[model samples]
Target: MSFLSFSPCCVKGGILPGVPRGDYDTSTLKKVGGYHVNSSDGMIGDGKVALVIFADIFGLQVPNCQILADGFSDELKCHVFVPDYIPNPPPNSAFTQVAKTFPEEYANRPWYISLIEWIKTIFKAWKWIPTFLFQGNQIRLAQAAVDNLITEGYTTIMSIGYCRGATILEYLLSSSSNVIQCAVLCHPEPKPRLYNHINRPTIWNIPDHDTFFKSNEVDILKRIMGKKVKDQGLEFECFVHKDTVHGFANRPTLDHEATKIAFEKVNNDAIEFFKRHLLQ
Candidate 1:
């Protein structure tokens, strides 16, 4: 099986700096059309175009993901829905433990020791097993969410996915579905089987320093997508962020100014892509 199908790297990076816990305002949560969506102050726009944000392993409950959804809603002037496809969200306590201990542990121990500890933190049952078993189900749920949004008067829809969710979105885009007009995938796992099935305009946000996908692997993807786009008359674009790591879009280390800028630029670029494709 390809690393994209079921790799431990798919489950990595559940924890990041500045993710919120219990203090997140539930008032910003509500069912938009038929799916539970998080938007700025729970606001839902009346625009014909809508965005579906397929969240990372942290699911819709993560503050950063919610904030990104809200940001998309405001920036695109479109109704954005973040559905919880992962029924059992990875435990916050496990990530919290890592966040609390990583810095001090890294300072005191060998670099390999800290790396081992970080691996131990993310390689939990909730992260890996459910991802393998329910990836297809996530695709179905995302399609259903988009269908519901269409029923609610959205004439066109676009999707954005992060990490494992990006893999699911790849499936969604490849499937014979017409509800989603275009898609943006961030740090997606490489699935060669589905690449041939993508017929719509798509954008891939590739990080320069991803551990899961090495430079050669990214080059292969670029070659494949580039050839396919030309041969099939499909629109495909890739943005490789320099000085970035995996999961920087949603799970950014905000302390780094470069990471912050990368996130904003990618977010804006995605919105503009949707505006060009979905709104026009």
Candidate 2:
């Protein structure tokens, strides 16, 4: 996890692979507990274990995030929630339009076209960029949402986050305030005091070459987490996928075979993770 850097190129992401498939159906989406929930008829889990998906900058509106929420809900047999923590979308604009639908919009686009459009997107989305970058309010909302879930009687809760959501997940993981038991982070740009606070098991799905988290920093994070597992007996694992870039797991371009593999790998790994942790 290239220390989940806040580099200039964080805005310039790579191919987000996979078309929505499996149980990633959107028809299951509904409103529950002040969030967009993926469930059938508003029921969440067996009132036992549940999962929370902290979404990327694309927020809960994008198919990318919805797919994850829905798929995880079905596979894990646990209801999932995507909090509407990012409030008040900006005035309609080209960037907002693309952010809302980049999964389908860029599905077949060539890398060059995607690059150009995204570069343009950065400039066009000036109004929204700051919102994604400064997630102070969102962080509070997400934390409170989890607290509310616990108050509502969910016995076990786990979370997985992508990019911006990863930043917030780290905040949750490090806190002593919640009973959150596990985490899955995809290409997260982790915050400072990196290993100081995480109180539970965490899994990382990161790319080998990504401007977002950097290769050098990945080595450092992996090393520290490995030591924590040994010295503190807390579980931790990381997968540095070869020949991929940042955002590959969450929003892969799918134009390349490696990216497609990366996407599937992430999904499979997360399922196994939750099954092992939550089912036991």
Candidate 3:
């Protein structure tokens, strides 16, 4: 991925710096009165909010990711940026060749590490940096994407991730210059503990799905929330959705009736939170 040069206010030395205080012009929203789409694919709403989406380990090109993006885009009057960080390998991919290099423990971990290991093994097999650099390069690519969008005048940012993508988003929120004004994380894995430190309007939905979710991660989450989180001297609004697994937002895997109810909770709560807390 190509490196980005930050503006003066958002730079310290040569590195991209933290967010600078600047009022956003939220008036120039695209009207959606006559919105039309040949298919229900990627239909964005006419709300005056910009959205940033972090796809699951597979990336945003997938059907499920596009549908979620379309829903948010239409309701938020926003543009969704889905970065293709993972390069898709050919079909009937040689898993054994890649698996030989890494231990069995790494294999059992989340998809991100598995992808990283696969790239490393692929590099060992192919002797090319492209394969090995895919993981790191994709992250930097997402960062560059944030820089580009910030300059293009996006005020509010919301990140939706599942599994390994959730953990990566936590890292991005910590280091990126575009401090998301509003954010949502669905069925996050490695349970985002440090998110309590983030003062921005944020939501964390953890589903009771994989071993990672069932493991001691719940204890970790409790500990994170146990600490005092004071923004404007008020406690943040956080909701925990029990009995739901990870990737609850994906329509294909989701229990339609339950998902509809759950999403109503998320969408209504998030929109209200952003309006009350952020737009104040």
The CA lDDT of each predicted structure is 0.66, 0.68, 0.47
lDDT of 3 at 74: 46
What TM-score do all the candidates reach, one by one?
A: 0.76, 0.75, 0.58
Worst 10 residues of 3 by lDDT: 31-40
* TM-score of structure candidate 1: 0.76
> How much is 87 displaced in model 1, in angstroms?
0.8
lDDT per residue (tens digit) for residues 165-261 in model 1: 7888888888876668889999888887778778789888878777566778777777888997778877888888877777777776544556656
By summed lDDT, the worst window of 10 consecutive residues in model 1 runs over 1-10
The TM-score measured for candidate 2 stands at 0.75
Regions of candidate 3 where Cα sits further than 4 Å from its true position: 1-48, 89-135, 176-178, 191-197, 230-238, 251-260, 275-280
Look at candidate 3 and give me any clashing residue pairs: 44-73, 44-74, 45-73, 45-74, 46-77, 47-77, 208-244
Note each model's CA RMSD in angstroms.
Answer: 8.2, 8.3, 14.1
Residue 157 CA displacement from its true place in model 3, Å: 2.7
Greater TM-score among 2 and 3 belongs to 2
